[model samples]
Target: MLKLESLVFDNGFARLPEAYYSRVCPTPVPDPYLVCYSPQAAVLIDLDPAEMARPELVETLAGNRLLPGMDALAALYAGHQFGHYVPQLGDGRAILLGEVKNAAGEGWEVQLKGAGRTPYSRGGDGRAVLRSSIREFLCSEAMHALGIPTTRALAIVGSDHPVYREDVETAALVTRLAPSFVRFGSFEVFYYRNQIEPIRQLADYVIARYYPELAARAEPYAELLREVARRTAELMAQWQAVGFSHGVMNTDNMSILGLTLDYGPFGFLDAFDPGFVCNHSDSGGRYAFDQQPDVAAWNVTKLAQALVPLLSVETASAAIGDYPQQFGRAYIERMAAKFGLPPGGETVPLLMDTLQLLAQNRVDYTIFLRRLCDFDSTPGALNAPLRDLFPDRPAFDAWAARYAAALRQQDSADATRREAMRALNPKYILRNHLAEAAIRRAADHRDYSEIHRLHALLSRPYDEQPECEAYAAEPPDWAKRIEVSCSS
Candidate 1:
């Protein structure tokens, strides 16, 4: 058995007043067993990777056993869900098991999603299905491997216990790790209730913990708000450059620390459709791929409103106003990097022109980017691989001519340029079809080998895993039928 003393726990969020959250223990599931484990994430919490295979670890992760210093709780907050304010929404199915300081003394909160009900249950069963649990567990790691900011997953515990979603599904639990789970909604709750004291307390706590450098600023609170806005802008830019559709960008789901938080109905672009909406529940396409940058700005404006008590209206507005410029600069820099062009180069026009061409042809986004990495600047060399991706041969050739001209402006060797481009463009992404296939195998046959295989493949998404070439291909016709909603 792993000793409780082996872990170091610190309950920082619990230091706030009881109004911030409710103390609760997870409702244990029966017959807990390990479904998947992340060795990489284990090191972040100072846990030995080998310990993940221990039988007792499953019980501890399933919430049947509490390690020493574990002060479990469910946080409270409110959010605007789909543009409507739900005045009170909290962690209905997730429980914070407490914080563990790693070898570097950095603290990470270890929480279990699908660990039963809390005061914020809102009359629904506080259980997570195996399908969704597997999705979160794998996608978290995949996002991290792609060099994107995101919360990490430690392990998943599965059980025979039943959960009712679209159908009766087996229950499961995922252990999630992040510096803090606080969201924009955390402040909105107190702001809406006119609870000024707790609002100030939360701000001070967050600044002291996450934004310590801002503590000495003339307007610490205002600077904190600006920093959050800046980080959120950069995060959204990365999402857009990589063709990731968050599906839902609710204020509550927006991480204050700028990490990718919730993983519901999220999908990477298979075809380059800027207007794609991954979440079926988004009837109006409010959170469509193209609208994400604007929606993210709107969400930051809401957070600014909550901080009005501490920051002047002018100060808040100015900080929020900085989002568009921040997002634009970040997006341009990332896209430039993708093409191996220096920032502010004339190559930007070619990049934009290529996007329009991609949309016209409905090209596979990932495959196109990966193929471009092998682009030959040499004359008379075949550009067939990239040209074949588009149906309009002449249109693609015109764009290639401009791209080759841009490449000539660079003074680097072909091999060096290809290597740099390959590093930025991922060879693997957690596609919707890949996730659905894994979920089906686990749900129908109780087989979990696909889950493990994907975890391994996604851990090194940038590498060319020749053995897993099939995973890098476009989805088949049947995969287009799979629709993921908010329920996913």
Candidate 2:
């Protein structure tokens, strides 16, 4: 029940040296208005949902004005871009407004993406368009609903002011909330500069604030890298299980805290293609759907390299050496849960077979997995619904028989297993087609109803909401033409 005016503000990152960030104010926009607001995220910082109705709320979020507690600034960091080291790349469009502690005393940093120019703007306008802004806002909530760690979106503010990308688009700002906005690049920038003391200070700040348990360890810096590797591995497993493609896995985009930091050119599987490259700008397909795990491991290795000054080469390398094992175990365990089976090396073959079959036939990833929940293990129990998804029904039948036999080995009951599997495998994801539909409605006609509808639907993605059944359907043919770039 907190009001905007009543909320106390603090900037933890701002307490760092001046070189860590650039002081900046949000450049104002024209005729700012509220597009969508998330009450679930709002309550995280105890912001009253009622306060969203105030004109000042949109004004504050859109950089048209500021609340008494607000102190905006853009952070500084450098990162690897497409495996090449970029010496400087900070928050080009994102401005951290301030940080606030929720009722449970969990700190949440409030940031405005597309709030205009900063030192790291790199000669480009620090503006986010309506299309990309809406995608980030919805996917942030969608990922969170799926029990995945991600930065939360509080609200989106739109304006009549035009921003040019491939086409002319209206400007928008998404208010992002996170425990901390620090990334792997936050340390990489200093490490590459050979600034060892600043890197140590940054490491100390992170350990003291976020990973306090590691501070007591004999080798805290190495322990921190190990902990980050573990988290990144687990997160990659979740992303893979759910068929999500984070088209950009730059070190800067990888959260130091292991949350899904940046949402750009991201997609959920339509037809199962392991090499699905959602980012149109990524012609090289480096961050493909199936490549996420390896990419994450690479990013973590880059993080270890950044911390090389604090820890020995062998020490830093050893800390993250177990990343592959960690990722493998986590992914297999999740796949087992989706199949209502126990986690073991034995289950991996069945899991791999399921993926292979799905890919070979180009089956709709979400639908096939959800339908598998009802697969009857009993001999001669017709799995027509499951088999119907594949163009190659014979291939599916072979896979289904193996899966059924595997289920029998686990001694699972059909009804009990179906219920459990449904919980793990979502019926609805923030599909690119769905998001595009909502964005078109909002951008073209200024109709915000679809955005509200999508938000409500995605909030309970695991539920069988019969009224929203159309949303669970496969993508239409035209959806193939929908392209999302790095800018998105």
Candidate 3:
């Protein structure tokens, strides 16, 4: 055992009944090595910064050894995979070492991804590749910097051991910190099994830990479902605004806190295409870009069904019903911010219709939005910018006349709105081409400088970093149509 006293167990989920989790230690690996440790995570966890970089600390984090007082266990929860129910799916590869109350006094589950197999391993070897580990580290931090709630990565540890996939690769573990690892699938597992007491116990545990205010309500369980819907809608709206595609919308992958969790085969849209599908395995495009909002609602509806035992039929349906209106309001607000216009019913729909037209004409999503924010008082002034995103100048000129007329009716000055929109709209996104280039260099040449640079650039994506203007440009030729999938 490492050292238990220095360790604190605010053990939120562990407080739930025995069926919800399996108490198991991480099966240690061989020849563990440190890859990268985020000092920011150390600060978040309130661990000693110097100790976090220590060799022994790295070994413990890599699953080569156990930390002192670490009660590592794999959580048990089932989820719906692509709209199909998996009665028992849990942390196959990940092990929650324990919970720790950070300096802020907020409890966070500190888990080791790729730690080794647990009861939920499902006959497959529990391992993670270095590439995926690196992506998770960078993307988690990048999202957090972008003001999106997400599970944070404390460190990524690579081991000498190799694993087989399409090819042999080194193994790695990501130390993930989050308020809870419980998913929508977790609730689904017990409901499908008809385990009512465990469901109530788990719901109470969640309300106490994360949604404390809900505990005061007359019907905490029903209120919990509604609260989840509200948060999920807001989260989906944020994803839409940022042009992020989660790639996999499995119920197990959805965090209850409305934070982005899994980073497998995910991509940021470099060009605006509403139907953009990132996951190649998703042949039906069930989780396509435009379909995300609906998919999120669908997943939450499953959660609502699971909670029906604890909630009245009317309450459950009412919670589910709020999804459309909630998502609509949140999405419109986000879109309004992107265009620097205060949200109103009429202008928002007109903007949405205009977006559809642009999509039909194959407009560059980020570039078109950014350029529209910079137009002068007259329609003619925006011709060049509009034409750049359209097939021909005349096609854009006609659209620009209508767009300019709409803008002139607003009270905000064109310059002020432009400046405001610039703040809301990002100049840079983590484009697939750029990410691939960074990953390839790191894998082939052991160069992390480019990766580090890209991470920094994405941190403040909305700002115009004059020296880093090239980083804001769209992907070059040969980079489009690249397929990212759920496999890794």
Candidate 4:
């Protein structure tokens, strides 16, 4: 077994001023129980399985005990939620347990979400419900399996306690690891407070830790902002291509390393609805499915504004101006992969036109895209998984004709195209209906078999798992619009 010292402790960020974080320990919970464990995450952190799965270690993970050298602290940051500035929204429900290096020598932040309250609790119990914990755990693993950059979940620990939201629910904690938990909001806090020195130090630390290559540049802060913008745009593009709706694109939820974090009220589009809003608390559909790119652009502009003090006006403007074009290029490349076509200038408009048709016709997002993998010149041979998507065959025929014509010019063989399309198009997504089913099974019956099954299938989402075909189907009538709350 690899000992703890085998993993390095290069604590660069902790060397900064103490005001950036609050030195506090997790307020332990009672009678912690293991809910789930990630063998893959253990391998990444190189933790011994026997040690990690032990009851004592599980209790430590649940915030009921402290681990050796673990400096659990609540990080400080501010964020703009739904365009409303919340100047004091820090880690009200999370604690950064500590930092550790993996076998690959990469530093990762180990955080405990719902590990009890801290100084930043804001008068609320800093505990997480089992329902939300399950969703986050499954989705983090599912998103990673889909090849999207995201924070990985280490384990989940459940307790015999209850928390009140809409009703009483069992509480749990999730241990998640990431390269850095710093956010756009972290910089915003300093800029809002007019604390430029701390902002400068924060920028320098970010540049050194995440974008080390930029630290040597003449304008490292400007360069750092641009790197984050470019990476964030690409991440948003990837999300759109997969029909993902983050539900909450707040600045704090935005990772400095461009990872998907804070999975709350998130959903995958079953049907192609551009205006789909998964978050029930969002009275206004500000962060809809199609509006993610715009939200990302807006957030990057906010980041750019925060760094303006460190940059010349012209440099800031230039970096800001590149967002649209950069997002266009990145989004198109992902679309090309989805359609099994080589990426180029012409492919963009064609894909956009097809998307317009899909949105107009209200087609099933996953099924429509998945079927396109088998699209050929023989029009009538195409199979429709859901006939309601197109009222008649002629509508699909027209689009299929155009698509087939484009495919014919490709240099790649049909088999290769089909294989590539299958690889890019996921066979499974965390549809709200499916996620609800899994959560219900666990919460009501204490049966985690469905959760385990769904996890296994989602891990290989692009493959044809013949036995799991039912899991990929559309939601039932009742689940079509099940409301999801911010609390869970």
Candidate 5:
């Protein structure tokens, strides 16, 4: 079991030169308490799940106490936000508590969000409010449950201390776990500064730690670029297939390892609008639902530019060249599995038509997809309830006929297909309203049961969870009024 008192941290990132980060101790919050935590995440570092309830875990997470071997500091990096390049933007409010190995001997970095002021704070109050913290904490775990790669939330510590956002709200800190928090922005900051050595050093460090297999390659740096592009394409495809809009696809938010790194202003597709902008602050809809793949390619290109000093321009360009095909292939394969159809030309059009059908009808993406698992190849009265979901019966009939034909061609059995599709198309997603509901009870009444309830429900997203079916229902009218931004 991982012990809070004696857990040894061997921080690889900290071993890099002082130029990569700012050594800063986390500023403590007042009267902190555990909001909720993930037992699954606690197990990632091989800690006993019961340990999450202990006071020391909450204290350490709340920045109230520093544990042994914890080399606390904030990362320094810059990125392009909404397509505009910012020369220097770093961890303004987060402090890395250093890294430790799990039972499998994998190093995981522990980080605290809303841990207070750093050199990168830039005159703003470096504290995260409970509102956004709940969203991040829940969604991080929720994404992982859906079989998507994302950073894990270990715990959330709520504080009575007030923090200002749109309103005066209480402070909260999230303990996020990841293999590495290194982003495309990490290399960008050095490149923009016209410093070659730091860029090379950062690249070398990343290669050694995460991409060690590339060490002996003739052009390891170029290979790193290709691998990043490939992984990023796959990540974007996963996001798209699941109807997830990251809201902000900033280079800094884009993980170098292709994990869903940051969780700000994110939303899942409620009504299948391709132009859905989850981040209200994004005036131009730059990171829209349908545009995620294209934006990801754009971000990968930025990472390629950052690596120009380490490899030839020709090699770097070639590395990112396959992004479109990579994303297309991965997306179709995932969508095919969600439809329980093997990916091929025949299934490709069915998937495209499904998207068109969903977009045209403005259907509840999750519900419609989940219900499709029980699709009958021989449609009859059995499909009436499914048919009721579409506004236009004719449109639904046309698509249903094609889908049925595809299933018949594959000789897919209803029982087997239903099981496969149900596993891929989750019954539960972190809908904005559901997250809002959890945040409300936790913030307004100081009752965190909803937070605990949500973490449990989302952890088994693919399961039926018949008792919690209300969570998988269509969003309410009040959900439309909810607007999240770059704030928090």
Candidate 6:
């Protein structure tokens, strides 16, 4: 029902100087086929979900053809990868297929990842494998459903073309949607090159599109830096609260809008180990579960440094100084909500103590949090299920007593507290084991039912879907066989 001619395209980033990006067309892949599509994402751009199955849609998605008014380009940027600064790291395997304004008049950029090699492809084949594409497609929608800010996937297209990573995997492409693909590294590239004009121009363009309110301010650019810092702090807090370990917290992966960007080697904690590292490539654990907040702060500091040319050094430093407290406050508030306590309440120490107990016991993070919703102020209420989760029963009992006491101090009814906690705690997360099961089925058997099923289940993560209870259970020992890395 959707017509490509009806869509309005705007090339905002391409309107910038040639140095900002390289105008290129995605290399056509042979025999393109549709793998899966997201109906929820389809509505965002006013596209009919039924239209996604059309051959024309598949062709456009797979880079075999272009939609009307499309102006494809690859963006240029730099990044600090695992503490080392890379002077030039751009969209090597992705092509921005221009921006489309939906019926609501809001502009969204449609990008095809793993399309083909660009000027930025650093001696590597620019193609995404089926395994990683499926992971990203599922996880992006899952993050959005969990009420976390992130880029969304419209559809995924596959091809018969062979791309080599760990194996000679078949190629695939994911159509990702975002307001802007600009990253913190977008500014860093110019600053490092001593090209102050491009940096200023990029900042001005970002302000005009994303932060228009700041455009009228006296120090719009400084305010822009401060706003980005605040959003990044809050985003990191959300990730920590949800037990998500973004394996690579590199500067390039940090979105200027603070949405979780570049979903590679990302994993939700299976157990409450703060030191858990999901990426096999992260041998040093630079991006461990507990280290995310600090890594995010460090990345934000790099962004602040890039803005020094536009704002006073003192102003930028002051903005960077606010990150820690901002992160601390946001983390405390989110964690407190999960434990059914008021923001900045007196029972914060009890919440911290409980986390330590969970970590010590290696309790399953998602299960333990969801189970806490059943806690009541009564003495024996939490003894059976909750206490059994910990090896040290006495330690857990002591913590439960404190938690019950804290609950008694509050005036809310038992049901009210339970409902609040349930809302904050999700019953489902995109577990690594579950993702692998789906991946194996798709890759080996060419069966994609599991992918569609997961997309449906994860879209309502907070709700208890009894029919899919097996998806919520803790991972078995065999599940540990699944390993993710930067290659993912």
- lDDT over C-alpha atoms for residue 268 of model 4: 89
- Show pairs that collide, candidate 5: none
Model 4 lDDT per residue over 1-488, tens place: 45543544444556689878887788788888787767777677777756665777787788877666677788889989999888878888999877887667777888899987888789989899889998999999999999999999988888868888788998889999888889999889888898899989998888877788998888887778778888898898889989989999999889878899899989888768889998998889999888899998999888888888888778987877788888888888888989877688567778988888887787778988777776664445464543346765676677777777777777556677888899988878888888888889989987777777777788899998989899877678989658886886
* Residue-by-residue lDDT tens digits, candidate 6, 1-488: 25655777778899999999999999989998898989999888888898887898899999888877899999999999999999999999999999988878789999999999999999878889999999999999999999899999998898878888988888999999999999999999999999999999999999999999999998998899899999999998999999888899999999999999999999999889989999999999999999999998899889989989999889998867889999989989998889888876676777778788899899999999998888877866755777788899888888888888887877657788888888889999999988898888988888889999999999999998999999999999997888899999
Tell me the tens digit of each residue's lDDT in model 5 across 7-106: 7777788899999999999998878998888889988888887887788788888998988788898999999998999988899999999898987989
**Which ranges of candidate 5 are over 4 A from the true structure?**
379-382
lDDT of each: 0.91, 0.93, 0.81, 0.82, 0.90, 0.91
Query: Model 4: how far is 231 from its true place, Å?
Result: 0.4
Off by over 4 Å in 6: none
Q: On a 0 to 1 TM-score scale, where does candidate 1 land against the true structure?
A: 0.98
Query: What is the TM-score (0 to 1) of candidate 2?
Result: 0.99
Q: List TM-scores for all candidates, in order.
A: 0.98, 0.99, 0.94, 0.96, 0.98, 0.98
Query: In model 2, which runs have C-alpha deviations exceeding 4 angstroms?
Result: none
TM-score, prediction 3:
0.94
Backbone N/Cα/C clashes per model: 0, 0, 4, 0, 0, 0
Report the Cα RMSD per candidate. Answer: 1.3, 0.9, 2.5, 1.9, 1.0, 1.1
lDDT of 3 by residue, 261-301 (tens): 88987877766689888888889888889999999999999
Candidate achieving the largest lDDT: 2
